[model samples]
Target: MDRIEQFAPPAGTAGTTTDVGGVIERMRGFRSHWPPGDGVAVFNEVYLTVTETLGRHLSDGAFRDREAVSTLDVRFAERYLAAVDTAVSGGLPPECWRPLFQYRLHPGVRPLQFALAGINAHIGHDLALAVVDTCRTLGCAPVDLEEEFERVGDLLVMLEEQIREDLMPGPDLLQVADPLTHLAGAWSLERARDASWSAARMLWRLRGAPPLAEEFRSRMDAGAGLVGRFLLTPCR
Candidate 1:
């Protein structure tokens, strides 16, 4: 199996609709960050935007605290929610989702069972801190039952709107519902708006120092060893 084979053939985006070549191109084309890297930048942008939107809600007593999650996180959450029905419906993707889940859970792929919003919110400081603390105790990133249950109900509601009511993708995750799940209508126009912002965010993160705080920069740049270990860390 390939590295990404863990996730199933995404439910709606497979076949001629998604164009595996296009998907590959897009994945490879993800040039959202540099000097440091794209992955960090992408996450950082989402982090900052969400934190910024949180405003007075953050502990910092000001708006746009990079460390604290914010309203933009909801936007990112919305994106994940939009893509989730497709992301999870297929048992699991043979690639990204399943492989990662199986690797973490071993003997099984329980992580794949998590809802979309669950996964989206999982990468933030709160979740990251929890895992870090847990890892410190275990002397390794403990691979246990994935934690996303708290977010499932909310995620499902958002997904229902994107699919049933609003009938649209949030704008971060690539939309697989074009001409497939949704053809011509206001959704097409909505897609254009979402895609533009998402693309811009990607570009911004890849180019240089993102909106994230200095500490996050330090953590990301800590070293490849730590990050790689993080990649393989279990989801439970």
Candidate 2:
């Protein structure tokens, strides 16, 4: 099968599940489906590692509010899974997700580019919205979830550093003059996490104003997609 076919959801796993374990299961399914070098697989592998880490923390009672954190984690994962389903079903994913899906199989894009582009889309767009979704589901406010958000963000940050270390081209090949170096330098996960928190707060405030919330979401999606496009610039 082609890469896209490999990404297709197995017979009964297309719908989003309500638990972190379920989300991790779906991601693992994707990992097994795609080739090691497949762009989506690259991102899936990174995400899977972070999610597994979060799950361990949850089991170990690491969070102050386990239920809230669990809800947020599951909800957060659902957004990305939904995007994958959209692409698999031949529908348009959110603008922020478009670039990675569109360029998934590009020969010119490195695995690092694919991984970062997917991270950009997920954090830049999905994260803020996930916060809103989690709040709505739990009948809580954004402020209430601040600690949980930070904990999750910290896990992601740790995994991101590992991803860079593992995927980056060696010093002999990745020079200051390389476009990959420039692209990698241009985006910061820490910055993205801060922006996502701000956006989540803004979105929460706009919730009562549906039209405004949608407009803000649309703009954020578009802006993120633009960045993803830039990150995926064929560096080969």
Compared with the true structure, all predictions reach lDDT values of 0.30, 0.91
The model with the greatest lDDT is 2
TM-score of each: 0.22, 0.97
List, residue by residue over 147-201, the lDDT tens digit for candidate 1. Answer: 2212322333343344333322345532555332222132232232233233333
TM-score of 2: 0.97
Model 2: per-residue Cα lDDT over 22-100, one tens digit each = 9999999888777788788899999999899999999999998999998988888898999999998778999999999
| Clash tally, candidates in order | 23, 0
Could you tell me how far off, in angstroms, the CA of residue 166 lies in candidate 1 after the best superposition?
39
* Model 1 alpha-carbon drift over 4 Å, by segment: 1-61, 64-71, 82-84, 91-98, 107-230, 233-236
Model 2 RMSD, rounded to 1 decimal: 1.3
